[model samples]
Target: MSNDDAYDNSGHIPDAASYPPRWEAEALAFRHALGPRAVTNWSYGDNVRQVFDLFMPEDPPKGLMVFIHGGYWRRFEPGIWSAFAQGGLDAGWAVVMPGYTLAPEARISRITREIVQALSFMAETVPGPIRLSGHSAGGHLVARMLCGDAMLPAAVAARIEGCVPISPLGDLRPLIDTAMNADLGLTEREAAGESPTLLGRGLDVPVTVWVGGAERPAFVDQARGLAAAWGAPCEIVEGRHHFDVIDDLKDRDSALMRAILG
Candidate 1:
């Protein structure tokens, strides 16, 4: 298989094209139902994409959970993922869904920095332990925060309670040869600097590397590699593929939720 085929999540998932539209529709309705609880347009930077939507629970928040969306760091936005905030909100945690400039417009390094900015911005208002979750490229981004090079503020980094990176690309060097690299703009130099698995050390926050049992082999390898590197637990949800693996996140009582919230 070619490089892209190795990470071709959509081609293998049945009815793959329909998922985004369904997510978009669900997100629209979810935001609408939240009404005043859904705080829109909290800007973290000057760029248009540097805005995030904050979802509030009915009561005061218990803590903060930031769920980053993934499209290989090139697609999707905060608004398209509002529905995913349900599990966190219902569990009494304020959810922050932040948007960053996508690839081809912003390189991965810059995008990582944008996340740092977003994290600091969100932490300013919501006080409590901060947990993280992300899918695909988003998983990579969240992992970046724990790596030494991320340079997250000592104050903000210390508040991170745990991290759950779902189907993360722990190592970006392989992507350097993929067709998506034209858009991702990954390079050996950059990957060496950015790949979480290659880092010598990172923060001591509890990290659980999660991957769907049926996901592409590359993803499973990446997940195991991350867990091994960090000496964290690796949870593989059997029978789930890349796309559906994160569906568990919609249920507040799901194992995925408990793992991240803990």
Candidate 2:
């Protein structure tokens, strides 16, 4: 594989091809099981991609848990991660999974703004403490929310309880040399400015960086770097890889879920 190709994780996870459908199937079933409890396609912006799926229990929610799907900022949507809402739903917390405009069509900064819009809308609509978590590129986006440039409203920003960036690319500079940059179109300044590692302890909310033990070294290092920079903790899911490490979000009783809830 080309050096750039190596940096693109789509080629690394052998089971990557299977996860979309698996998540889709699980999400569909979970939605069906939820019936009236689930709210799908809640729009936050004018763009078609600016929407989210929210799941809730019978009682008023104690808080909101939002999961951002990862596809290097260019692939996948919220539908594939809806099943992950199950854990929080069972715990009496509302869960939200948002879809944002993809790369190539939208620049990274634009995507960042789009997510901020989504978060702002949800914070107003849901009206509760919000905890954010994401995988891969989604992880990067969650981290970006902590930056000063995100421009979240004071009321909305204060409602954020915690953040868990899983297998995040905290440093975007390396990605400029990767094959995905053709789609990402990141300039040097943008790469440096957008990097969580470079931003240096911008978050006021608590952060917990997570990665799979079996993930690429770069991914592990990224998690470690972000944790160290933010004075946060890093949790490595044993034997999981980039694609499957997020599976823990589906299980309400898992340690990952506990960490998020805590």
Which candidate number has the best lDDT?
1
lDDT of 2 by residue, 1-262 (tens): 2347545565788967887898889889989988988888989999889999988878999899888988888988888788888788888888888999998999888998999899988887677788989889899999999987788888888888889899998998888887788999999999998898888755588889999998888889889998898899999888988888988887889887887776
- Candidate 2 residue 69 Cα shift, in angstroms, is 0.8
TM-score of each model, in listed order? 0.98, 0.96
lDDT of 2: 0.86
249, model 1: CA deviation in Å? 1.3
Q: Candidate 2: list runs displaced more than 4 Å.
A: 1-5
Q: Where does candidate 1 have its weakest 10-residue lDDT segment?
A: 192-201
Worst lDDT run of 10 residues, candidate 2, spans 1-10
How well is each residue in 1-262 modelled by candidate 1, as lDDT tens digits?
4678889999999999999999999999999999999998789999999999999999999999999999999998899888899999989999999999998999999999999999998999899999999998999999999999899999999999899999998899989888988998888999878889988448888899999999999999999998898898999999999888988778899999999898
